[model samples]
Target chain A: QKEVEQDPGPLSVPEGAIVSLNCTYSNSAFQYFMWYRQYSRKGPELLMYTYSSGNKEDGRFTAQVDKSSKYISLFIRDSQPSDSATYLCAMRDAQGGSEKLVFGKGTKLTVNP
Target chain B: GAGVSQSPRYKVAKRGQDVALRCDPISGHVSLFWYQQALGQGPEFLTYFQNEAQLDKSGLPSDRFFAERPEGSVSTLKIQRTQQEDSAVYLCASSPDGNTEAFFGQGTRLTVV
Candidate 1:
């Protein structure tokens, strides 16, 4: 099984709609969960990060992690066209130094105006 | 104030040719990372450096791929005898420390034809 799995969604939503992106992992050691946004032909940008299991909110974006279920999610409220991008979920074990990140195939999100 | 920067934003090389991609991390950052992103996939870790020391290279796919951060600030990923499978975006990122969030470069899109 892949270490991390995500739906490669070309999910289309109208502007102002809410969007949810999710990923599941098999590794129970992963402690740092992150969400990245990537545009076509560009590198992925870190959007939200969370340590362990909890919910973190920053502006219109929220990140939630459930270590028990090995699931992580990124929720975008009031989505806009500019929010269209590939959403990637990545995790790193708490080994404390330069640990490699495991990533899921990103889900493409398109918010139509 | 500068984010991570990469040179030769786009590169096209014939198969079997060698290619070198450079990355300039945010100043004073202590950790540097290299990742590869194939089309429609999320970035995967390649190697990591803590300052000038290469601490983890377990993620490197093969001997043909090598990365170095000789000066502890700027880094390079060199692909020897590039193959068509090497066609992907090479991303560089840096964090203030191993436990911090990372900032990524725009990435170098390498196409091996």
Candidate 2:
């Protein structure tokens, strides 16, 4: 089984709607969870990062991780057309450092105006 | 400061040919990483470098894949005898340290036909 699993969502939402993206991992050792946004033809950009199981809010985005469930989520509030892109979840064990990020297949999102 | 930068934004090579992709990490970053992203898939770990030292390379798919960070500032990933399966986007990222957030490059899209 892949260490990380995410829905390959081509999820479509209207502008101003709320968007929620999620991922699950089997590795209990994972301590750092991150969310990344990738536009077509571009590399992923860091969106949200959280250490361990907790919630972190940044601007219009909120990242939540439940270590107990090995699940993590990213919620985008008041989404806009510019927000359409692929969202990816990545994680690593606390001891693994920044070099060993394991990533889940990204969820594609399209926000129509 | 600039984010990570990669050269040859796009490459198309015939099967059995060799290809070399380059990455310039953010200045002074202590950690560098390489990842491969196939179509519709998230990025997968390839190799890592801490300054001039190659720390972990277990993620590389085969012996044909090689990466080097000779000066600790710029890194290169070379694929010898590329196969069709080698077609993917090669992404490079760097962080200030083992625990810091990583910044990614625009990535080099490689196609082995």
Candidate 3:
């Protein structure tokens, strides 16, 4: 099975809508979860990161992780056109140093005005 | 520079030709990583450097691919013989330390004919 899996959604939503992006992973050793936003011709940019199974909120974005279920999610409230980009889920092992990140196929989101 | 910088924002190379991509990571970052991103896929690990020492290279697809960070800050990824399959965006990232969040640069879009 792929280490990380995500739906490559060309999801379109109207502005001010609530958007949820999720990812599932097969690796039990993944301890750090991260969400990245990538615009066309640009590299992925770190949006949020969480280490434990819980919820973290930053402005209009929230990140949730469930270690037991091996699932993670990013919730964007009041989505904006600026948020239209590819959202990628990434995870890293518990190794303190020399760690590598495993990524999922990103979901593309478009917020129409 | 304040952020990671990758040169040659885009490149087109003939098949079987050699290509060398450069990455200048953020100053003082202890870890540097290289990744390849296809059109619709997330970034895939390529290689890593902890200072001038190459600690992990298992992610490299073949022996034809090599990366180096001679001074522990500036790094380069060299592809000996480019193939059509090698057409992808080469991304470079750096972190203050092994366990810290990483910052990525705008990738180099490579097109191998």
Comparison by lDDT, 1 against 2, better one:
2
Candidate 1 vs candidate 3: which has greater lDDT?
A: 3
Clashing pairs in 2: none
Best by DockQ: 3
Q: Where does candidate 2 stray beyond 4 Å?
A: A96-98
Instruction: State the C-alpha lDDT per candidate.
Output: 0.93, 0.94, 0.94
* Candidate 3 lDDT over residue span B76-96, tens digit each: 999988999999999999988
When only the first chain is scored, the TM-scores of the models are: 0.97, 0.96, 0.97
What's the distance in Å from true for residue A86, model 1?
0.5
Model 2 per-residue lDDT tens digits across residues B48-90: 8999999999989999999999999999999999999999999
State the lDDT of candidate 3 residue by residue for A1-113, as single tens digits: 79999999999999999999999999898999999999988888999999979999999999999999999999999999999999999999986455788999999999999
Clashing pairs in model 1, backbone N/Cα/C closer than 3 A: none
Rank the candidate models, highest DockQ first. 3, 1, 2
Q: What is the per-residue lDDT of model 1 for residues A75-105, given as tens digits with 9 covering 90 to 100?
A: 9999999999999999999865666788999
Candidate 1, after superposition: displacement of residue B107 in Å? 0.5
Candidate 3 lDDT: 0.94
Candidate 1 per-residue C-alpha lDDT over B1-113 given as tens digits, one digit per residue, 9 for 90 to 100? 99999999999999999999999999999999999999888899999999999999988899999999999999999999999999999999999987878888999999999
